[model samples]
Target chain A: MLELKNVSAGYGESSVLKGVSTTFEKGKLTSIIGKNGCGKSTLLKSILGILPLSSGKVVVDGNNLHSMSRNEIAKKVAYLAQGKSTPDMTVEQMVLHGRFPHLSYPRRYQEADREIARKAMGVVGIYHLADKPLFTLSGGTRQNAYIAMALAQDTDYILLDEPTTYLDIAHQRELMNLLVKLANRGKGIITVMHDLPLAFNFSNTVAVIQNGTVVAHAEPSEICGSSVLDEVFGVKIERLPNDKFYYDY
Target chain B: MRCYMKSLPKNKIANIYGIAILLLILSAVLGVLLGASGISLTDMLSSLVKGDIESPEVKILLYVRLPRILSGLICGAALAVSGAVVQGVLANKLASPSIIGVNAGAGLAVILCSAFGMIGGWSLSAFAFIGAFLTVMLVSIAAKKWGASRGTVILMGVALNALLGAISDTVITFNPDVSVMSNDFKIGDFSSVTYAELIPAAVIVLITFLVLITLSNELDVLTLGDENAKGLGMNTSLMRVVFLLMSALLAGAAVSVCGLLSFVGLLVPHAVRRMAVTESKHLIPLCALFGAGFVAVCDTLARVVFAPYELPVGIIMAFLGAPFFIFILIRGKGGHRNA
Candidate 1:
């Protein structure tokens, strides 16, 4: 399990994640949902060590995260950031980059490296585009390409920050399904998503972040109700005939 | 079948192949005949095959023309490869040793050495290497402390170049052997190199070139941006240090051997990228060959164009490279942000 205790972080002067504490269990698809500027991305960044924590302890599987080297942390946790773009590399080359932490000095790719890359690309459904230059690929394809690179790392914990942002409807569903599969296979998958329906239906648990704090953490069934949605999203909820809550603009 | 083949990388591959062959042939042929005491093309060829020094011109051709040509060839390749690495790492086309303070750093080191009366052909080269290394180290430090954003680092490089240039100018103004030293180092004449003295510089360039080619793939990965590279498990910091060191070695070697020849460092890589879209594997080699060939051709023209009264290779390159640089600047007007 990945756990953060009293995590407080900010850009330069203004603090964004203020004393937020949360626990994400293993083998569960945990979705963090919130309104804009609620420190959702900041939470993920702190988890990935991209953003410095002002004062907090993050532990993964009984080891203090702050104590581990970036390479060591990278071996255990695979992070996917929002607005990530593919480099001018082929999909296979992109996937193989994930193997960097596994190799020692003067690293060389063995047969197993190629197999792992191939398998990861296959999982992301980008195996056929392995030879295509990443710049030439569509937005959805490129996103999948990056996800595949993360998967090739074979880390136990997968943290994604808005993975479905630029993807189409189908691609978004496909990516969410891939996360579900990964979680089912015992990987700790945590994603910050804007799609409330997908978060409610696909994720095992939903963590509502509001005002720099994770105010409510529960099973999706319990948290997706009208009262909880209004409290987190800061909008009055109306129950529609479709049994889904509707909110005014 | 033909349509499918056309859509493949055939055009780029063919262009590269044709250019490589043509450059190789031109370099070999031009290296023989372009000298102060010009040997006729036929005698230059005949001397090589027969090992017969029948004509007075043939002896000069054998010794002077061969060594000078080799110097241009090696230095060009070295500068071009250096530029390619820097550009790749920074992901910016404008980044080059000349623009960034690598060349200036080497020049300043040699200048300081000359001031202390440690000036000689070989020792001067060593000073240049030290200078280049120091400049790169300074830039790396500045980059790290002040956010290694591509634009910020490039600006720091320009500032360093100006600072070093001022120091060099001040030293040259006060020095006793100012005229001769300034003239030799400023314009980059190949006439100074002999066959034997050029070997060390040549070997250094060759070894660095080989090392650079090995890292081209890693460089390609780098151009994808840092986060992506890190996600792949590559030690991004270590890779940057290695690349910066290698590029510094290359720039230092070229400046030490040939003085400051601009444009070849900046233009060759840009031209290569424009003509082809491949990973660094193909681009780096192409840059090396093209850089070497471009300089050789320019030097040959400098020797033969205003024949006997010969221009410096650096001057000829300025003439060739300046126009192209201007064209790029104008065409690049308000289009595509500098990377």
Candidate 2:
């Protein structure tokens, strides 16, 4: 389990996350949703320790996250940044880097590391593209490649920031389905998403952030009944006949 | 399948290594054989085997040509590997010791030491490394202060290069006795290199190379950008500093020996990347070998192309390197960064 207690973080002098507290349970898919500039991404960065905490602490399995080394944190949490450009390398070469924290000095990937990487790529259904340069892959496939790299880390928790951005509707569905599948297999997954319908439909838990603080942390069905979405997003959400909610400004 | 198309088979990697080794050997032999002294390959080899260090031909081969050739190989490898690391760390293909003011900074430092009559070989090399390290630090600070965009960093380097070059010129103008020495340093020739002068640089370069090889995996992670690298459990800032220090040591050692030889750093790494994959594990070693060969061959041509009239290897490198630099800019490979 990962827990953030009154975590406040910011960039330079401007605070973005002010006393945001949230707990992410294992074996569950949690969607963090908020309006633009509501600290959704900032909260994720704070959890990953990429942003220094202005106040409070992040604890993982009873150990303070700040006390752990970067490699130690990496063994427990895998992160997929929003969008990243890699150098000219094949998918396999990129995925092998996930084993970096696992190897010692004069690091060389052994047979066991290779087997793990291969299995990770297989899990993402990109085993065939392992040899192909990432530059040549489609946007959707590139996201999958990054996911495969994260999976190769073999962590219990995975955090993604806008994994569905720039992806087509079909690809988004594919990615969401993959995340759900991972969650079902006993891995904790947290993602920052903008699509309310998808977030409500697929996530086991929904975290709603407003003005740099998490206002609601509940199951999707429980969140759907409250007026919090209207107050947080500044828009009225109507329940549609097809079991979907429509936002009207 | 896409996988089949992208895979780097083991056999191909082996072939690339084989070709690089072959080129290195061929160039080294040529470097030893063809010089102003007119020693043929067969005679040199026969004398070397017989341990005939007394003959004039053998003397020239052992005392003059051997050290010069070895200097060329070491200097070339150092500059090339430095360029490879700079490019990787900066995430900009245009980043090299020469272009990013490292060579110029070292050159300025060496000239300053010479002007001040600080002529100790080891002290001179130490000064060069300090100068190179300071220059890179300045460039990095400026880039960070404004924005660390690739263009901003390269432009800052260019500005620093001009300023350091001017200072070096002023120092040389006041010290007339050091003018002749400055001329050789500026043009970058290997004719004046002695075993005593080459020893310190050779040791530094070898040690740095070994250290870099051990850190090649970390370097690969760095190319993915800071946040991504941190997410993978790397201390990105610390890694960057270490890599830059290694790069400075490499360029500083080479510059201490050969003056300001340009473009081997840029051209060799780019050429090696084209021939092989971009993984630092392969790139660093291949760049070192291929770069050594490339400069050795270029130096041999500069020596023998015009009989009895020697051209500085830097001049030859400039003629070859300038066009390639332009080509890289036009192709926009160095300009590649996500907005």
Give the worst 10-residue stretch by lDDT in candidate 1 chain A: A237-246
For candidate 2, the TM-score is 0.94
| C-alpha positional error of residue A136 in candidate 2 after TM-score superposition, expressed in Å | 0.9
Candidate 2 stretches with Cα past 4 Å from truth are: B1-8, B45-52, B179-181, B321-339
lDDT for each residue of candidate 1 in B36-81, tens digit (9 for 90 to 100): 5755888766765786786666667756777788888888888898
Report the C-alpha lDDT of model 2 over B238-284, residue by residue, as the tens digit.
88889988899999989988998888888888877766467898999
lDDT of each: 0.77, 0.85
Candidate 2, DockQ score (0 to 1): 0.59
True contacts kept of each: 0.29, 0.74
Error in Å for residue B78 of model 2: 0.6
Task: Give residue B210's error in model 1 in angstroms.
Answer: 3.4
- Residues A149-240 of candidate 1 have per-residue lDDT tens digits of 88888898888889888778898888889889889988899999998776766788889888899888898657645377777666543445
Docking class of 1: acceptable
DockQ of each: 0.29, 0.59
